[model samples]
Target: MNTISSALWPWLALAGLGAFHGLNPAMGWLFVAALGLHRRSRGLVLMALVPIALGHALAVGAVLLAVIVFGTVVDATFLGRGAGIILIVWAMTHLLTGHRTPLRIGMQTGLAGLALWSFMMASAHGAGFMLIPALLSLCVTPGTGVELAASPSVPISFAALAVHTGAMMAVIGGVSLIVYDQGLAFLRRGWINLDILWSLALAGGGIFLLAG
Candidate 1:
């Protein structure tokens, strides 16, 4: 079972990172909670999670698709370093302007609009870019041409995506529910700037990828 355990570790890491993303207030739970309050229905917050999760999935999937399609053509080290640099840049951008950014999702935004907004937010946060190292490990093969074309890692990549998305949904949904029922006043008692923490995490993840 050691072999199986080793293989499953990366997939577990993906899920863990997703959970980490979900815990951040800037991700979606805060918005969902606010939307529920605006709509005067806690159920709306739960419903909002579906589209939010889908949007996040799409943003991450886009990067995964690129890795899968070009893993053979591009060197893994180059791809990993490129993504790492992008992520570090994104993290710095967040640190500098995340709070000052005037972009805000209006309560009037419909489900589809919310989905699109979530996609953009996730992309800007380098959520998918953070997965580059895992993608390289999973999809990049030591073969050329046909051998590389029939990569065994394709299925593993999809499985990792599903696991990550599922974990994110669970965290977002649970947090939204609690925030909705308990009210935001309690959460604001000792306001912590989670954005800075998240930005640092992004930078750290990028560094880890580059180190690997």
Candidate 2:
């Protein structure tokens, strides 16, 4: 049990972070739900998730690929420490201004628009950055070079991305259902501000990377 737990925790953390990102107000669950409601089609909501997930995966994958390549040249620990400080600085910036208005996507925007918006949001929030500590553990072999050609870790990195995005979609899909059924009234009345929480999480991720 202990052995299994130790091996699984990092992947679990990635999933948890994905789930949290899914719920971030900036991710715009309300907009997706409202759009589905306006159109009177639950299928639209499900369809919307596909693009959103794709955009998020693309955003994170782009950064992960770069990191994997760069890891070939630098010590992972040094890179990690650098990332940690960056995360903390990003967190502070986000905390100070994260609640500012998100990019406006009209209610009538198409799936492609949603995809673009999601990509921008994930990028602006530094969502991919939050996953690096866990990802580095799962996919990047310490003191190794060029994982793409010679290492099994390439496959593992892809799996990690899938796991994170899958978890995110699950949360977003489930919440969209609730919001669709209940309408915007529930969200308006029930939703609480998540900016501070997200900021703290960002800082926590930085600290975790630093601790390693």
For candidate 2, the 10 contiguous residues with the lowest summed lDDT are 141-150
Global lDDT of each model?
0.77, 0.81
Candidate whose lDDT is highest? 2
Candidate 1 structure quality by residue, lDDT tens digits, 45-155: 989998898899899888887776766566666667677887788899988877342356799989998888788888777788767666565655423222124366577
So what's the TM-score on candidate 1? 0.86
Flag regions of model 1 displaced more than 4 Å: 1-5, 99-104, 141-151
Q: Which candidate has the top score in TM-score?
A: 2
lDDT of 2 by residue, 26-62 (tens): 7757667988998999999888998889888988887
Q: How many clashing residue pairs appear in each of the predictions shown?
A: 0, 0
Instruction: For candidate 2, report its TM-score.
Output: 0.90
